[model samples]
Target: NAGVIQTPRHKVTGKGQEATLWCEPISGHSAVFWYRQTIVQGLEFLTYFRNQAPIDDSGMPKERFSAQMPNQSHSTLKIQSTQPQDSAVYLCASSLGAEVFFGKGTRLTVV
Candidate 1:
């Protein structure tokens, strides 16, 4: 498919464990965006990168959340010492111009 691909559609982790989510953007896209969705907060922007360079990550948690784009084809989001509060559907999107394409997302559940 032409859409972004997110791995492990569902994940279960123990409290204090680490969780890493993977995303592969569309082949020629220049920008990738990461977001978190939960019942309390509807779709919150976490971070984004343009040309594989991080632009902003203000919405990302300072302590445990981290994102990286090692190359143009893919990006990753890692959450260290995951907590119950960190449970949410993490979305990955890629854009070329005005329209953005999104993946099914990785659902993280911390217990």
Candidate 2:
């Protein structure tokens, strides 16, 4: 599919381990967003950037969570020392204007 691509549809990590999720946005999109979905929080915005520059990351944890858009084609979200509470469906979305396209997301499970 020509939509956003997120690698490793499902991921399992042990407690205190590390997990890295990858995302490739649609070509020509200038804005990218990272979000986390869970039964408790629903969908929560984690961070976003435009033109590969970080815009806002207010929802991200002050520690152990980070995201980066190193280039136009892709972005990565890394979680260090993952805990069971960190388990969620991480979503990646890209937008050129008001319309945003989303990937299937990477379901992370921390045991």
Per-candidate TM vs. native? 0.98, 0.98
Cα-based lDDT for every prediction: 0.97, 0.97
TM-score result, candidate 1: 0.98
The weakest ten consecutive residues by lDDT in model 2 span 1-10
Q: Kindly report which residue stretches of model 1 are placed more than 4 angstroms away from their true locations once superposed.
A: none
lDDT of 2 by residue, 22-80 (tens): 99999999999999999999999999999999999999997999999999999999999
Candidate 2 is scored at a TM of 0.98
